[model samples]
Target: MGNYKWHPRFLNPPRYRKENSQLNIHLWNIMKARVSTNVEKVYERLRVIVS
Candidate 1:
């Protein structure tokens, strides 16, 4: 996700932007769930991202 969102990488525009603080904070929250090492929590994060 980070790779494609960066310069000279994606073939299309990123769905969200780092310049937008909301998106940055959202991404941070999603990534934070990884530390818990639980599939259910990760799925919940994906749900948050999608909706």
Candidate 2:
């Protein structure tokens, strides 16, 4: 196994700016789409959250 170290920025992201956040949101949407029983329902929920 390889040793891994966490970066300081990863522990504490800067506030009021969305750099890494957007990636997280994108991943969340993808995951929801994959597992969702109703794709439209998931999309509606995401729209409510994002909007």
Candidate 2 lDDT, 13-39, residue by residue in tens: 566358567875677688777777587
Candidate 2 at 10: error in angstroms?
9.6
lDDT of 1 by residue, 1-51 (tens): 657655543423456465675766667678877666688888899999999
Any idea what lDDT model 1 has?
0.66
Against the true structure, candidate 2 reaches a TM-score of 0.38
Instruction: Work out the TM-score per prediction.
Output: 0.33, 0.38
The positional error of residue 17 in candidate 1, measured at the CA in angstroms, is 9.3
Q: Pick the candidate with the highest TM-score.
A: 2
